[model samples]
Target: MAAKKSEYTCIKDNTIQNISRKTAELEARADYKDKRIDEINHNMEIMNNKLDQVLNSFNDLKLQSTSDDKELELRLKAIETKLAAQEKTTEDNKARSDRIIAIVSVILAALTFYFNYMH
Candidate 1:
């Protein structure tokens, strides 16, 4: 009976050692997984910051493009206005020339008629 009891005690000790070993392995795996999660979170933060910078750059470029486009549109409108004014001035000068020519022609016709009647 004493020999049987010693045998049982040995078996129990081995089982406890096995359990402890398994527990240690599980703990190590859990720690490694936690460290990996932390690294992933850090990398994610860096990526988010980079993405934010890119978005800000895009926004600035968009604003500058919009401002440049507006300025170009204004310049085009001013050019169009100047062209219209030049066209109107040209038309007015032509009308004045036409009136002067008509008056000169009438005066010449009247002079010719008077001279012919006198002769």
Candidate 2:
């Protein structure tokens, strides 16, 4: 009876140790998984912040481009107006020069006829 009891005690101790080791391993895995999840959440927050900053910068650039386009359009319109006025002025001058030449020719022809037939 004494020899049997010793052998049974030895088996019970080994079984208890194995059960405790397995429980501890499972707890460690749970803790490691929770920590990894927290890390992923933290990284996602950082990425969101960076993405918001980029979107804001893009909006600023779009506004600047729109303002620049309006300014360029105004400048182009001013140039076109100036060119049109210059063209009109040139046409007026040509018409005035034509009238002057016609009057001068009539005066010269009258002088030539009077000198030959009367004087």
Highest TM-score model number: 1
Residues 1-119, candidate 1, lDDT per residue (tens digit)?
45554333464888899999999999999999999999999999999999999999999999999999999999999999999999999999999999999999999888898898965
Model 2 residue 37 CA deviation (Å) reads 2.1
Q: Give, for candidate 1, the lowest lDDT window spanning 10 residues.
A: 1-10
Whole-model lDDT, model 1: 0.95
Q: Candidate 1, after superposition: displacement of residue 102 in Å?
A: 3.9
lDDT per residue as tens, model 2, 27-58:
99999999999999999999999999999999
RMSD values, in order shown? 4.0, 4.0
Alpha-carbon local distance difference test for all models: 0.95, 0.92
Residue pairs clashing in model 1 are none
* Model 2 worst lDDT window (10 residues): 1-10
Give the best candidate by lDDT. Answer: 1
How far residue 46's Cα lies from its native spot in candidate 2, in Å, is: 1.5
How accurate locally is residue 110 in candidate 2, as Cα lDDT from 0 to 100? Answer: 89
